[model samples]
Target: MTESRCGYIAIVGRPNVGKSTLLNHILGQKISITSRKPQTTRHRVLGIKTRDQIQAIYVDTPGLHRGQKRAINRYMNRAATTSLRDVDVIAFVIEAGRWTEEDAWVLEQLKNYQCPVLLVINKVDKLEDKAELLPFIAARNSEHNYAQVVPVSALRADNLTALEQTLDAYLPEGPHFFDEEQITDRSMRFLTAEIVREKITRQLGDELPYAMTVEIEQYKLERGVTHISAAIYVERDGQKKILIGKGGSRLKSIGREARLDIEKLIDGKVMLNLWVKIKSGWSDDERALRSLGYDDE
Candidate 1:
């Protein structure tokens, strides 16, 4: 019998580089929330992919950003950098044709890790000229000695098989850490909050996405139906008013979209209750950050 192989793989990159998209594509499930907005993912989410003789535990971290103005930003940076320390393989995901100062900063941090790093250039499908890939790969490879460089379109799920094979090859031989059936380590309550937050990000204006977060106040399951009551936290009453909108129309729309996704997630009937609350300065307060579930540990 062939021995099973399992190891932790950390996916690291700057904000808006499609790190979450790549993890979702690899797991074949939407464990991480995504939006077009930068910093859409504010927490580290773990996704497990188990195949024949291989189990890859992938950590989808919040994008490492330069801003540490808010306590939440510090928490996110801590979360992203901490995941790199003990992983067996590090997948440094980046956009195919773009490099930024933030990306350079993240690369500098990767220098501290001794593990094999796979340079995954995501969003190749967006490149109009296919021949441009070789030069891009060549230039990128020269910057760092990656164990393997793979170009893939995470959005389109193109070249993922090769990427997966490369990851599988680097995984250390050992017994599987998680059972084959388990996809993620996060609980339903956590996922519910994330789903709600995703809806908020998608439904709200650009200015409001970073100011708000979802907290599941009550979660209960009875008679084949799940009931969830959540509070959306904002720093001020004005932000709260914007989220609630005229006669609460905006909040209702957010709830409607979130409910559909929650139902699909749990595969059961869902009754969702959403409330907007003012938590003034939660993002900047360490105590408030902890209360909002931003505990780095």
Candidate 2:
């Protein structure tokens, strides 16, 4: 009989580099949220995948970014960096043709760890010339002693099978850490809040400030329908006006989109009510950050 294999794989990269997208596709589910905006992921999400005897627990982290201006920014950085502890394999993800200072910074951070680093070049689909992939991979590979370098388009699920196979090979021999049927370590309430935040991020795009966050005010089953009330917090009254929109149309639209996704998530009917509130200086306040569920621990 094959021995059970299980270990942690931390997917780390700069903002908007498809770290969350890769994890979601790897697990064949949407546990970690994504958006065009940078730093859409604010927390470290665990996505567990069990196949036969191999169970891979993937840590999908927020983008490791520079300039921790706000308390929230600092919190995101801590969340991303702390995920590296005791991990078996580190997937150092980056864009296909673009390498910025932030990418270099993240790479530098990996040098301190002893685990094998896999240089995953994501978004290769966007590269007009596929031939440039080899040279780009070669250039990145030379920068570090990577265990392996794999190019993939996480968005299209391209070459992900090979990536998974590579990760499976690196997993250390051990008993399974979680149940074979389990998919993620995150709770449903946390995921629901993340879904709402994702919809708002996708809807508002650049118009939405980084100060926004979602808190589940209430969640319960009543008459076979899941009742959820979430508060969308912003830092200023003007931002509140922007989120609520004219005649509450924008807020309603956000609620409608969020409710549909939440229903799909729970596989049940949902009554989602969203309210925009202003809480001045919440983002920069450490105590407020903890209360908003941004706790680093």
- TM-score to true structure, per model: 0.98, 0.98
Q: Write the per-residue lDDT of candidate 1 for residues 14-84, one digit (tens) a residue.
A: 98899999999889889899999989998888999999999999999999988899888899999999888
- Model 2 residue 264 CA deviation in Å: 0.6
The collision pairs in model 1 are none
Give stretches of model 2 more than 4 Å off: none
Model 2 C-alpha lDDT per residue in residues 162-281, reported as the tens digit of each score: 999998999999999898988998888999999999989998978875969999999999999999999999988888988999999999998999899889889999999898888899
Cα RMSD, each candidate: 0.9, 0.8
Clash count, one per candidate: 0, 0
User: By lDDT, who's the top model here?
Assistant: 2
Q: State the TM-score for model 2.
A: 0.98
Tell me the lDDT of candidate 1.
Answer: 0.91
